[model samples]
Target: MSYSSHADEDDDVEIEEEYLGDYASVRSIVKEALPFQILATIGGAVAGFIFAGMTNELEMIPGLIVIAPAVLGMRGNISCTLGSRLGSAIHMGLITKIENNPELTNNIYGSLLLGLIMSIALGIIGHTMTVLLGFESAGILALTSIAVLAGVSSGIILSVIAVLLALGMFRFGFDPDNVVTPSIATIGDIVSMLMLFLSAKVVLML
Candidate 1:
């Protein structure tokens, strides 16, 4: 009888956790995503302000803003995917620790490589579209160089943050999958914008 009582208590606790974590209904779905949305909105506003302050940089490197959205989106997508993968790994018991794991290392490497290729492609596309639309372009080489530099740098930073944040949240008994997407979107926006502006400055000097 004692064993049966304990089992019932455990089942109740599990049910409560499921209710809190899962989107079984509208209230639960909002509960899961609301905080992240609030944070993401604030981050996006900050990013817009940062972009506004880059007027000088914009003039120095024409058409850079055209690729800003692409850069931010790419970073967010990669980081979100990494977070989701790590969360799954944690739940599946594949990763008990964050450090010294081959899986984590390989994931980081793959994200970086993908970012590099996208950076080059975005640069070319941005330049081509700018010229085709009769807008001033800083040239294919300059735009491509900036994208590669900024994309690689932001990708490295964001990949680490994604892994660490997801692991930390999972350890704390929070739903990393629920939180990672919005959290990464916010962080990725800020980091990608900062890296892009800095890269533009560096490319200007070259």
Candidate 2:
């Protein structure tokens, strides 16, 4: 019995060591991801500049300035969550191929629903805040329209990008967790800003 116990302990130690060595350490993750993170940050900064350039037009819509940042941030949040989920699925071997699987469908639907709900909430909150601050603002209908349109459009695009990045990274033997979130965030910034601008234009015209 004592000998059996000792053998079990050795097996456990070997398994633990193997597991520890299989996973990435924090330093290694940071080193591998730093260059991509820097590039993504630069892309986000360019998006910010583009957003700044559109301030004149954005100013024309009352309370839109308040909604812009919230919408952009929410896009990143939603897309990052999606990316994380895909990365986990990839690591777990749940996603063998990028097809119309139930898991992928559910994730896409959930992200879209979350984006829509959050967009509407942000619209209402932005309108209320602008009113409280003694600023002129559009009605809830217009605000909601703009938010939903922009968020849904951007969500669709970002969802596809997130999935593709996860799959591509995994296929290339790179951990998706190390690259997907930052990449999605940067792309979300650019795409969300552009979508918001276009949505606002369309909403105002209608």
lDDT of 2 by residue, 119-200 (tens): 9999899899989999999867778888999999999999999988899988887789989998998899999999988898
lDDT scores for all predictions? Answer: 0.87, 0.88
Tens-place lDDT per residue, model 1, 8-63, is 99999999888866635567667777899899999999989888888999988898
Best by lDDT: 2
Residue 147 displacement (Å), model 1: 0.6
Error of 2 at 169 (Å): 0.3
At residue 180, give the lDDT of candidate 2: 94
For residue 152, model 2's alpha carbon misses the true position, in angstroms, by 0.3
Worst 10-residue lDDT window, candidate 1:
20-29
